[model samples]
Target: MSLRLAPSSKPSTAGSASVFDTSNSYGLHDTMRFGMRQIASEVTAKHPLENRLAEWENTQDELKMNLARNMYGMHAPIKMAMERSLVIKARGPSMLPRSSNLGLDILVGKDETIDFEDFLNVPELSTDMVDVHTVMEHQLGIRV
Candidate 1:
């Protein structure tokens, strides 16, 4: 979206100038138009934190799956031990804050343990986050 402001003595046949001041009447059409465009631009510019957050989430999922497979003895003992150590270190006391969910206190212990089954069982949790339709629209830039 683009906003342009041009002074004119009278409205053009093509389209009306966004803002105009005639006599004592002060128009703010251009200001509002530009403001909306600026807002959209700001929203679309993803923050550094968002990129980092997506990376961290991907890493966490990979680690969780590796740990789960190791715990079930699907992997070799040496590999299982390494995965267990990594899981323990990742869940250490100092890492508790990093595991916490903003506006949602779901962790249960100093170990930062959270039962995935129990968490998924919560009706509120299932409905609270962004829905698939909302995510699709946001990704596709389709505004209703």
Candidate 2:
């Protein structure tokens, strides 16, 4: 396999790591060339199978989260035990509000005339609550 080596921009000292410098052993170039080739191949190639597997894993994770939320409240002692376990393991500082993690594009305006992009991009909070009915009107408005 062909490997290209760019000329060094800096002088090599006894402590420095430079391939072109003659201060180091000549055999170092072969080792560096092999390492560079391995890294190049890893960076450029994408395996489709890995992408598919990751997508499947993400879907399964969402299903598991939904299942936990649905079932935990339905039962009594099981939910209590789960809460206790979670409490014991939770040693980190308190998390930030959910609004901090939300994306800008997720917000919906109360009417079509309102600019949703400008509403969402506001740095400060506008209101505590939202009306879904006002945001989404009856489907009868459209003939189709």
Highest TM-score: give the candidate number: 1
**lDDT for position 79 in model 2:** 59
Residue-level error in angstroms, candidate 2, position 69: 5.7
Q: What would the TM-score be for candidate 1 when compared with the true structure?
A: 0.20
All models, RMSD in angstroms: 22.4, 19.6
Question: 28-97 in candidate 1: lDDT tens per residue?
Answer: 3455433322334324545655545545544554555555565675565446456556654554322223
Model 2 deviation from the true structure expressed as Cα RMSD, one decimal place = 19.6
Model 2: per-residue Cα lDDT over 70-114, one tens digit each: 766546435544654664454432232234322222221123345
Steric clash pairs (candidate 2): none
